[model samples]
Target chain A: MFSPLIEDLIRALRCLPGVGPKSAQRMAMYLLEKDRDAAGLLASSLQQAVEKVGRCSRCRTLTEQDVCSLCHNPRRDHTLLCVVETPADVLAIEQAGNYHGLYFVLHGHLSPIDGVGPADLGLDLLGERLGEQVEQGISELIIATNPTVEGEATAQFIAERARAKGVAVSRIAHGVPIGGELEYIDGGTLAHAFNSRTVL
Target chain B: MFSPLIEDLIRALRCLPGVGPKSAQRMAMYLLEKDRDAAGLLASSLQQAVEKVGRCSRCRTLTEQDVCSLCHNPRRDHTLLCVVETPADVLAIEQAGNYHGLYFVLHGHLSPIDGVGPADLGLDLLGERLGEQVEQGISELIIATNPTVEGEATAQFIAERARAKGVAVSRIAHGVPIGGELEYIDGGTLAHAFNSRTVL
Candidate 1:
């Protein structure tokens, strides 16, 4: 309903997740009216990110370099690997500040219905990483995928593969969240919490 | 938290209204990971919009050209001018399809505390439009600003000026909305509804 440029901006803005027509229009108008300079900066930033950023060859996490900063850092535990589903999940773990291991991003979990297999998750490269090629070997493989059914199935598959390759494997623990209320927690989570109770 | 390019994109995305750091990061990751082409398109669109779009010379609404398409259209009733506060408001009125008059955008209402005055709203240009020198005379000026305190005061001021300049002035009526429930309607709106009841 606006000028061609505005309409185009609104249409393009729908590329972001959860933004519909109304929200896109509002965003376009806001950028045009309030912060054209910031809008210009945003435009340039987007173009640069798309052109420069790509998956790290080692871990599949997003990075400008072939090897990501984390993967290239010698101080981080290269002998320990945490496998995750996506780049966003990697960011989440990094922000948590507990993990010091190198990462391997699957980009997606194994979904049989969706035809996502081990190969699709880049397990062939993971197999090479776990193989006893170098004298200095990886000690543990931590499965840090989401706690959903697909994530569990994927973790099981990866764990079996790692064990067959003579490498230790462990899945991230699942129970109630740190500050979660018992009443609001789901039954499945409560069952997991009960089954995996840790002794004081 | 992310690469430099990714971080810049996230920061730039925060320029959007109501989007905080988390949402900006998510949006940036989504664009980079899933839809890089669309992100590129959005970037170009933002740049083009910022470079090209400017206020219409006559109406002060957003337009690419010197004269906006609305002001240039001979089919529209130029003699019946609707005054609004922003380009978004102009789009809203157009979408409603009830009014076929040309519009004059004020950009903002009379906010004396913020030092906004008649000159800020381009009332000088409006005065010229209302003047007697025009071959095709303006018969009426419709004040379609919002129903806030500032809006009412602005409408009153514009109405008085238009009257002095020999142009008829009318304010858009306010009461209960068409789909609004009477029980949920505020007391002031209810009173206005009672006072402005039409003889049906």
Candidate 2:
């Protein structure tokens, strides 16, 4: 459809989520025609990010430095750890601005069908951290993984392991979103909301 | 917010069409977390394209060589040229596979408020090509610009100019799309379809 270079660019662009061939072509043509400077900047920035960014040593979130800013910040509660499945989830929690605790990224859930297990997500590392944190008077380990079958299993597994080390474990509440209408909510979410009701 | 490198990549990625800040962050995180190799490939490919791809001298569409393959291919009908406002339009026409004639890309339509004029669209070059093509037995110039007010004005301006050069000019019809139901179609398009009904 186009020069090999242009075609290569279009195909390479599909690595991003939700971008299909048609969208890839549009992006390629737009960069080549109207936004070459930005394209160049994106290219260099992507390369820089790939070359420099790696998991934070303490929490496993993507960061340029060994420890992420959140983990390094003294204002955040090191005694409270929020565990999530991926770095994107960590970003979502941070953006909400309600959580002032540090994070420990699992990178993925324990999906048996997909061959992902506790060892694969560095649960041993998490167990070690939990054991070490108990000595430092750490109070809670919040499981913030997505509310899927695998996520539930992983949370329960982590809870059992952390409880053995004398650390308290809690799951993030599952319910309808704040602005959601109940009529439009799914049955599973409605059940969760009903099951988790608290005193007014 | 993330590290400076991550932040820069996210910001630069917003230059792509339809990608907002959240989408950009998701893309950046996905690349960093899962597909670093593909991310590297995308970065290098973008750089390669920005460095190599330039407008075809004859048609103004993007190509690595001096002339686009469409203009260079001898099998295409050289006598009939389809003029469009952008390279994306060229891709759309090519994907339709109905047009066997060559293309002349204007890069953009005339927009007075944006200070885009005939010269801005390389209309003088188009005039030269029209004049030269006429001597070489080129007969028809198809104006395939979009149906916006600016696009219509640009089409008319080019039509008058080409007609003055003794070349035949035709506008691609504005009407309801082939599979679209009349009830679902816009009034302007339905009216156009009514006026341009072909005798079956």
Candidate 3:
């Protein structure tokens, strides 16, 4: 007979982003039979991520430190910031290996129905970050939020706020779809979108 | 910039059964962004399992010791040995919660084209095991190999050899169709097969 501890371990493993019951069971058995170390690693990661990974103080990107690596790196252009919806999005862009600008992870797209607003995110800080243009010597703000209606609205709001501060602002060009994501969008289309971005 | 070490980590992570490129990427990002401890744990476990976990010396069942639990359990009917193709099959039978018999893991099915034979699969030891029945007080031998053609041949060969030693031996039942597995078969069918097993 299996122990309750093993059952609890399987249940916890099932909470991973896309792991289902069958996969969980396979993983559980694999851990129990052939790979207890892998199972233990998975468990430790779940606990560590839940406890440590949080929004970076500067850019809202998920980070183990106060500031994310992108935000702290001097080599990246602080003057040009490409904002994205989630940390997962940051990974997708990094995979493409082209984007050299700093990133601001919004964590969530604005969803009025979901009760998320400008203040719900770090929009105030973003606005302030943009308003420090003369001192920080900033130039462009690329609104790389998703093209869903909520994403569009958020982009527009940010663009207007940036323009009011007398800074140049642009949104990523639309080629994928109105409701699609940068993550699922192919790399070539994303490249073209980046190359042909227009003013908001 | 990402290092090859990161890539190596991702590549090693992708080796986990059923994990694809996207899942591997997500896992890598998860480790980097939030779960370094998990990564370390996984790394250690991979190294540990790779260094250990060989077949049981007695029964060829996957084990960290000379004898597997099923073979070592004093309560198990050592005289009534159940033969199976794989350790996974052993687990499946255990999950069914019916069979309380001990197991001898063959590690593979018979395939003439693959050059697998009785001697190659440690059948010599099995022969010795069966040959010792009168002295050890073993009464019955259960052939629980798969229902495939190769499985059937393997079971037949085992029974012929074991029965020559003068013990009551029976092949595990068969009612299911071709290429079907006992794990996915309905409990009713499995139960029926178990109860209605015929002598071969």
Candidate 4:
């Protein structure tokens, strides 16, 4: 419990995902006392990003304009595309600095439970975009979905659709994390899955 | 991994207390994708609170005014004062909903290891305030610090000071939480702590 204003502020902060009742209260108190400046900056950043940032017209990656920074960058390999499920996923990949290719954000996966299918994913437009890329000598498409069941299903669906359009499709390997240990490993057959890393 | 905007958003969200790397990222993604409208509201709220909220000059508690709501409320028993270590603690007591009094927020406890002592916690002013309350027929002073060791020490120090000023002092009791489980308890002494709940 905090002051009425603090309670209201924390209650408002509860809107963030995974911020439960206790955490919202803690954050509210922290902001009210410890880091007011940072909290204020975050508030302004939240609004500015939402208002200014949108999707790249071609790849659907988040950007400040019709095209994202990566889409506009001359150095990134346009022919080597990295397709991911969400905008956050793209940032995670980019942070590793291993890929110099451009990205296409799906914004979602094909969840039939939610009535989202291939058409909803903009595959037709993506196919046309791929044809346009073919003129630019596009060669490789890296499907880097997460290792979850839905991720695997979505990757498979994307690969199948992309291959039908004459694009070579490959998936990133799913294995133990770099610093993961066997004791904590649910290795089971994934130990076998890690060994059988192959191009699709 | 996520879009740059979402990544920045999550990074910004980490300013909150108890929000670690993973949860901040999840919150960022959820705000952008599943709950854009809610995110907008939260952003507005954060901005508003940061812009408007300030500590009460008298108590150092969060409020829109120079004095907090408790300090300003004419209905609160000004003679009966409650002292707490943080603005958060003040809220906890208020939520308990039995106390009808004014509060003095210390903002922190005396942790000598962290270099926090009497002056660091504004204890001198607190002493003066306690004296003022006693002169105004404030016969009772509630020392409602947390159950932590530092909190206990704080309450002890304040109680001693108040007693010297001819004021009656009391401390909130501690026992099992409302839905506590004994079997999953650590150390057989939890039951002892439960049995040993103290008054004052």
Best by DockQ: 1
Q: Which ten residues in a row are the worst by lDDT in model 2 chain A?
A: A130-139
TM-score of each: 0.92, 0.91, 0.63, 0.75
Question: Candidate 2 at B134: error in angstroms?
Answer: 9.4
Model 3 lDDT tens row, A124-165: 988878877454756888888987778888898888988998
Candidate 1: give its CA RMSD in angstroms: 2.3
Q: Residue B17 CA error for candidate 4 (Å)?
A: 1.9
Q: Which CAPRI tier for candidate 2?
A: medium
- Model 3 off-target regions past 4 Å? A1-16, A24-79, A91-102, A106-137, A146-165, A172-200, B1-3, B34-37, B133-136, B177-200
Candidate 1 chain A weakest ten by summed lDDT = A129-138
Compared with the true structure, what per-residue lDDT tens digits does model 2 show for residues A1-200? 68788999999999998899988988998888889999999999999999999888888888889989998998888899999998888878988999998899998999889999889888887887887734355689999988998889999999999899999999998899999999999999999899999999
Q: For model 1, how does the per-residue alpha-carbon lDDT over B1-200 read when each residue is reduced to its tens digit?
A: 57888889999999998789889988988898789999999999999999999988889888788888898888888789999998999989999999988899998999999999999999999988889456577899999999899999999999999999999898888899999999999999999889998999
Task: List the candidate 1 regions with Cα displacement exceeding 4 Å.
Answer: A132-135, A194-200, B132-135, B191-200
- Residue A71 of model 1 has an lDDT of 84
Ranking by lDDT: 1, 2, 4, 3
Order candidates by DockQ, high to low.
1, 2, 4, 3
What lDDT tens digits, residue by residue, belong to model 3 across residues B128-189? 77777354666788989987789989988988988888978987656664689977998767
Model 2 Cα lDDT, one tens digit per residue, B16-104: 99999889988988888889999999999999999999889999888888988998898999999999998888888998998999898
- Which candidate ranks first by TM-score, i.e. highest? 1
* Superposed Cα deviation of residue B148, candidate 2 (Å): 2.4
Q: Any residue pairs clashing in model 3, and if so which?
A: none
Interface RMSD values for the candidates, listed in order? 0.9, 1.1, 6.6, 2.5
In model 4, residue pairs whose N, Cα or C atoms come closer than 3 Å (at least 3 residues apart or on different chains), thus clashing, are: A1-B91, A2-B91, A87-B2, A87-B3, A88-B1, A88-B2, A88-B3, A89-B1, A89-B2, B79-B138
